[model samples]
Target: MQKLLEGLIKFREIDFEEHKELFGQLSKEQNPHTLFIGCSDSRLIPNLITQTLPGELFVVRNIANIVPPYHESEEYLSTTSSIEYAVNVLEIENIVVCGHSNCGGCKSLYASDEVLNEIPHTKKWLELAYEAKTKVLAEVSVEEVDKREWMTEQVNIVEQLKNLLTYPFIREKVSQGTLTIGGWYYLIETGEVFIYNKENGLFELAN
Candidate 1:
């Protein structure tokens, strides 16, 4: 409330003046460079982390940063629709799917059935993580619970990247070399970012 109002006042007084021309151009149209799909986590600020100015990255955020596989039904999914527009209309050259450390949504996927059942919608939504969990369980043995959660979070990024390709428009662009897809892991504590290399099937620090 009050703090947000004050922030707006400061933006009007200082920040707006600093970037007035950029804002004016943005008012006309936005030709963002990348489509950034990320989690709804407050700490995961895509623009701030990527050092992007206004109108640079078209963003679509959701719980767990999940991108559901393409469906033809009448259900209107805001995230998928936004991604479709970003790819088909805006023609963004790159799409980055970012997953972060200590993701509550991913952690909840492994919770007890009773706990998960309490949030029916969330549990249903998190079913997308099943493949990631299976992969993690097969590849990594977790002696501690926290490590298991973190591993699942990392694998979830890869899973979502695969799911992203399920869209026809995205697949077409990717095949034509007009679009690139990336999987990223952001570690909040270390302020480090790891990018998945399709060639290696591993996330290496972005250097």
Candidate 2:
């Protein structure tokens, strides 16, 4: 807490002062162009990784960067609401769903029921990635846990991207070519990003 307080003071004293003009303009309104959906991992900083400034990327961080399939009857969801605001209200054109290496949420998907019972809510939420896990398992056996986990993380990103399309407005914009979606995988130790290439159906290192 002390460290965060000190950092807040420093932000006001130095960083904020240095970017006073930019912050002043942003204080009026934010018109971010991209909606960045990333993991709630502290190591993954969306703006820092993309080298974007304030008011550039509207971010939504959640466990495993999951995007629940859109349902018309569902109401008052933080992720779904924010995504609607970003697309319909803010008119954001680009959306990036980023997944990182060594994610706790992804690893938890492989946890036994007894272990998952320790964290009920977390276990329930991770059900969003079950499809990804199932897809991986259909092709590979449990003996290869490491490969399964890695494939789960990658498949989860693409699965989330697919879920994003379940929203009517988002689908409309995408169909009209006004909005675009992207899936990204970040390697924490190497500081490298891989983007999903739809043409090749593979993740390739970002150029």
Query: How well does candidate 1 score on lDDT at residue 127?
Result: 90
lDDT of 1: 0.90
lDDT of 1 by residue, 54-118 (tens): 99999998889899998877887888899989998898999999999999998887788999889
Q: What is the lDDT of residue 136 in candidate 1?
A: 78
Q: Which ranges in model 1 have alpha carbons more than 4 Å from their true place?
A: 141-143
lDDT of 2 by residue, 47-123 (tens): 99999999999999999999999986555788888898999899998999999999999999889999999999999
Model 2 TM: 0.97
Enumerate residue pairs that collide in model 2: none
Question: Which candidate wins on TM-score?
Answer: 2
Model 2 stretches astray by more than 4 angstroms: none
